[model samples]
Target: MLKHPDTTNAATSKLAATFASQQQAARAQPYPDYRSRLHALTQLEQQFKQQLNALAAALSEDFGHRCAEESLRIELLPTLQGLAYQQRKLKRWMKPEKRHTSWLFQPASNFIQYQPKGVVGIMVPWNYPVFLTLGPLMAALAAGNRVMLKLSEDTPATNQCLQHLLAAVFPDEQVAVFSGDAKQAADFAALPFDHLLFTGSTAVGRKVMQAAAANLTPVTLELGGKSPAIIAADANLAVSAERLIFGKCANAGQTCVAPDYLWVDAQIEPALIHAMKGAFTRLYPASRLQQDYSWLCTERQRLRMRTLLQQAEQAGATIISCAEHSWQHYLNDGSGLLPLQLVLNLPEDHALWQQEIFGPILPIRSFSTIEHIFTELSTQARPLALYVFSDDKALQQRFLKHSHSGGVCLNDCLMQVAQDDLPFGGIGASGIGAYHGKEGFHTFSHAKAVHSKGWWHPGKLIYPPYNKNWLNTALRWLLRR
Candidate 1:
């Protein structure tokens, strides 16, 4: 989507100016010292802490009524944790890693130095705006890169709050925030950035990649797909249902890594669904979903979920609403309070099964045997996250080795991305590259090789134009392998 020509021109001009200014700043301080980086991270951390209440309130307002406490717990906490982690480990991460020189290159030293990639561009999505913005921001800042963030326009209130907080903590050159319409965001992506990272749906991710390709800018895409969960024949029904429900219901299942569907043993489908529905009711009683639970961030998303459900129903799928009241009663009331819904007997050609369901909907497909699950999964595009529930370690190992996903949880869901030490991303269509913790620092930096050779000059032996003896000897020794 784009705006009028005049709007596009204005947005392009503004973004170009910002990029130029940031480029200048990056040149002035190509690499910040460890102490300077730590201090800057500390400053941002303090500002984030001070504005926690406001940020949470802004998230609530932007989503029409998100639980402020939930915002703090889910968004503010992770952002702060990542900042502190980077601050503590920045010095060590900045040091050069010594590499072993081959015997042929004796008296030479080889090492890798992580250098800043100059100005970086980060595109934030509406869900978990604060955390997503800061997660990569910390990595870029830790690696000493100037950053420009294009926050989602769907989240105006949270974007305003982030703009104020970022402005108070860092200068426009060191860190810039852009909250604009789709046209401006499109223009921002097209800018020639040193590196670009986008977090959104696969369809939009492709467009972002296309725009970045114009500048030859490398991208780290964190996209969502049909992340599925498997319930093994021997799995614990109660624990699996509890964990799966939590993963699917969190943020009303708007999370990129949330479980999109479940492949369960046909014999246990009824029991598993019953346990999940009960667990959800306990988490957010059907009677009080409007008072306690989060709604979809926008009405458009709400409508999409509704349409998907209607489409599935039209195709003769059996629908099971988790709450006492149907999803429509809560989600359709202007507020997007949707409850967990289970779809069974859905046709393979149904739209719900074909795409990522970024709402509180789970399609339950029954598998007769473990092999049956693997056979079907092997034919589909790799998903972002995979969940398996079983006590059998060998079965777990089999899934681990056979399936390819961005991340996997042996007996749980959504826990893989929660850790700061882990690299979070997808593969294939799900995404391109990952960035979190150590991986993130390198993502925004270049691993420049620093090789040094002493004055010993051992290579003088092979300098002659005609050195038959040396050539034969070297070839004999080298070609022995």
Candidate 2:
């Protein structure tokens, strides 16, 4: 059962003690214990499927009218797919990788073994709670490490559901979940786990990294920033607008990797904006409010977006609110959904242009050429993802070569994250390590190099001989080789 205490001090002590006990137990256990742990995780694969469905339902209720299709696509599918992929690939991933030895070390054999890093702490974000939690949890479990998950306080229903589900299937000493306000999260971060993984905003990621540093704990930060979408002059306007708009508005533009702004070739800026407005109008018609758009997940985010929009207007930006069609009846009962919007012809210095706008509002800017767009993006902090829509292969290659971002989608946006086979991560500020496929497994595993050697291959040529002749001979032989 989940524990609750009247006093904050008592609760903190209790939770800290529980976490400490788990860490100690995992460390003190024998090799066989690791085997059992792996076996339990294997069993959890089947059990978690049903739990995921229930958890998704809980999450949908929490978000208030989040489409089941979107939840399944984003959350359930990714987790189950990760579990299945790991189950089939882990044995191969565990095999010691042998390396060829140099002629000088002929008698020695070298291999790199994958070892567990012990307990791992996962701090899951609220936007995609299930996948964010399971993504890291799976990696930790696959590498034979125990896990302690801290769910976002913003997602209370999802957090409670995850806590209940995990408690049912595993002992507290194996895996546990904790949830509370931001202060509680700060306390959780202070605990020294073998490794800590955090997925959230860039600002919060810094705090997490600093806290983990106090205990010398290794960290993998998956943070988000202002990812830009570049639409070239020669691109297919309809296809480009369709895909980019779909990605931007899919989660009501709340995604970290969502295209933050558009850098359109100046020649096509007018046409692209028209296409975007048309695409949004078709999906979220004013006639069908509930069926068309999803609500902003939290009131704080809504207020933030509202403030940004207001700021952009004050700065003389053109706010082209998409004409609402006919989806009004569904939203009559107080849904927080807003019409998809485009902020066009904004000056570079506008407040909305300065930060990551995590809403349906897309700020459109015009660039004269590819080089100019590249220079503009290069000046900003590396974004989580960059979308370059172009038919010219040469232009695409050139842009990629000069740009530095977390990930890129050629002629598209956001879909690159779905290609499970590829490694996904940020370079500098966006994030540290890649996860997904074998990369995820390796990220959570400790690879140790081992070398086996015997006395049979003794070097008699230079065995501490105090002679000039021996030294000369050795030097001559090394130079000749």
Candidate 3:
């Protein structure tokens, strides 16, 4: 059934109305004591966890799969993990950073203070909506700011569930959820947030950035691209193949970090493909829809995948489908389904080769040398992630040095983003600012430098500026020191 656009817009506004009211009240209160505001965080922590669990459960029912397990293992777990790590480090993160004072001002002090941007706007993506919202929300609240969350319209059921969950724990003034279609999402972006965070496709990210620019709001954009994986001739083919498959198939290839293309040493291309084929067959044996292999989220997504695969095939790429029963199950149910395909010998001109295939299809493009591969990659937009598999330490180091990407995996794949300790974000076209762990805390906060100096510190130094003797002595002393 087609969703009424007005319904989505109304739901979004209804949620945002509370935060709007709070913003008005806050202006009247003018810096309401943050100790009480800070104290609420303790209760928020427990309630948030429970809400996440419930939302995960609801998301599972809505998606009609083992979504609860996937949500817990993937989304909710990572969010809670970030919250726990931040909670442990918040005090230290909040500690004032000291700086050196000039020798002339002997008794003065200088330090930098981190302060919150009044209200933060978080525009979340449908994929992992729970984690995307929770992760940024944690950062905003930690910095002592109110948050307005714009949930994705792609996952309406999940957004509705999130609305209820957040409302149960927080009022509209402190935290609120906006559930809306594209227009309302755009309006939410234009709402004069002190800072805006958006996670989605590169095209949409540009629109969001432009919208935020209207208000001069600083933005953190997490966008997607065709991330590449290079399999060197010297690589351990078996290990590289296994890791690549895991990264590609995890989340059914919905992840931005999933390897979008493969650059194989021409001499080893056939062997690498064979190894990957075996890995896929072994991991997801063709007998279950509720297994390692999952269906594309919607029929539209499935059709898009089919179109890309067909385009690749027409361009003379050899396609090999992963033998998954999920395809057969969908076929039996009279539903559209696209197989997890592996394309071999794809030309650079094909859409599958040129664009980021955000589905289960993986394309292989051969390269004779690292320079040739890098030359090709350099022409494309910088990827969110790059995976290079090389046993030669020197080659690996050189690859890392030469490539500009959001993140890199030395001999593995997408697991780098899983490490909460490391900052995750894209560079150039892939994304804007980073977030995760301390990086996230820093992304949402602004540093204001503070200095304490006596009023009597510096009248004589500049009062007689025209004196050459004084200027010479001052310059000589400073320069010598």
Candidate 4:
């Protein structure tokens, strides 16, 4: 159903008014004390505990059969851990950071006070809805900022559940959640927030930034790109295959940081493929029908995956389906289920190679040398995450030094984002700014510089007197290398 233009404008105006109210409230308190922030976080955690099962079920229904266990493991656990980490570290993070002053300014002391950035706007994506929504919310709250969350319309069930959970603990003036269609999301992005954070496609991120630009709002975009996993020649094929399968198959590869493709040494390509097939078979004995496997969130996503596979196959790419069950059954059942597909030797200009494949399709390519891998990656924009499977520390370090990415996982995959202590974000097309741990606190904060001077200042010598005497000599000496 198409929404009326007048209705859309009215909704936008309503959201803006709410934002203004939140901003006013934030100004009244300005900086929330440690105790207040801790209390808010504790309330959030308690609410989650009470509604954990409901949240899991809501998320499952939204995803057309997302495993409740997967939702709890991937979404709820990480969010709870993030909340605990913030509660434990908020006091220390709020302390003023003392900075050393130069000898020339000995009488003055300098420090940075972290202040909240008024009202913050967060745009949540459908994939990992709970984790993404609450993860950033935790950081914003820890930094003592009022929050306005725009939940994804695709996950209506989860959105309603989240709205109820948040309302139980916080008033609209402190935290608000909006649920609507794309028009509402666009209006939400256009809001003049003190700090705005969005998680979604690179294309939408550009639009969000453009909208926020009119307000001069600082934005932290958590976007997705074609993240790649590089398998070293010396790495154990079995181990790499196991980890890669887990990372890629989790959530049916709808993750933004999921391995979009694999770069393997030409010699190990066959062995790695064999290992991956074995890994997938063991992981999902019934293939797409396995209870552990999550369906694509919607029919559109399933069709998009199918189109990518068909395009790759028609363009002379080798298509390998790792389905131990009948594919026709899944299609006839209308389960939105898709088998893990490996596309090999795809053309450089193929659509699957160009776009971020946010589904259960994994494109595998072989490279002869490390330089070749670097050369290939150099042509693309920085990815949100990069995975390297290698036993050699030197090789891993070299790759780390040469390659650019938001985060890198060595000898494993996807676990880098699970660490609450580490900052998770991307570079270039992948994302802008970071949010997690202390970095997250800083992102949602303004580090105001404070300079304290004693009553007896050292500037008496350099007062407004028009004389080039001892002070001038001292200045010249100080300026000298």
Best-fitting candidate, measured by lDDT? 4
Report the lDDT tens digits of candidate 4 across residue range 358-404.
98889998988889888878888999999999999999898899989
For candidate 3, the per-residue lDDT at 301 reads 70
lDDT of 1 by residue, 1-481 (tens): 6567887788688788889999998899898899888988999999999999999889888888888767766678888889889988888999999999987778789999999999999999999899999999999999999999999999999999899999998988889998888778888899999999999999999999999999999999999899999998899999999999889987889999999999998999889989998888887885667766788899899889999988988899998998887766765676677888999999999998898999999999998878988887899989999999999999999989999999999899988887999999999889999899999999999999998988895666666676578687876998898
lDDT of 3 by residue, 1-481 (tens): 5568777656666756765776775566433344544455555667777777668656654444434666677777787777777677677767778999987765789998877767788999866777888888887777767788888766777787778767777777878787756777777887878889999999999999999999899999999899999899999999998889888886678778899988899999889888987887776666543543444666667677767866776888777766644333444464433446788877767888667788788887788868987786678789999998998998888878887899998888877887888999999999999988788878877888998978667636656556768667887898897
CA displacement after TM-score superposition, residue 131 of candidate 3 (Å): 1.3
Clashes of 2: 8
> Which regions of candidate 1 are displaced past 4 Å?
1-8, 468-471
Q: What is the TM-score of each candidate against the true structure?
A: 0.97, 0.92, 0.90, 0.97
Model 3 stretches with alpha carbons more than 4 Å out? 1-19, 25-44, 51-53, 61-67, 324-339, 458-460, 476-481
* Residue 29 in model 4: lDDT: 97
Q: What overall lDDT goes with each candidate model?
A: 0.90, 0.79, 0.77, 0.90
**Against the true structure, candidate 4 has what lDDT?**
0.90
TM-score of candidate 2 against the unseen true structure:
0.92
As for lDDT, the candidate ahead, 1 or 3, is: 1
Please give the lDDT score for candidate 2: 0.79
Model 2: ten consecutive residues of lowest lDDT: 324-333
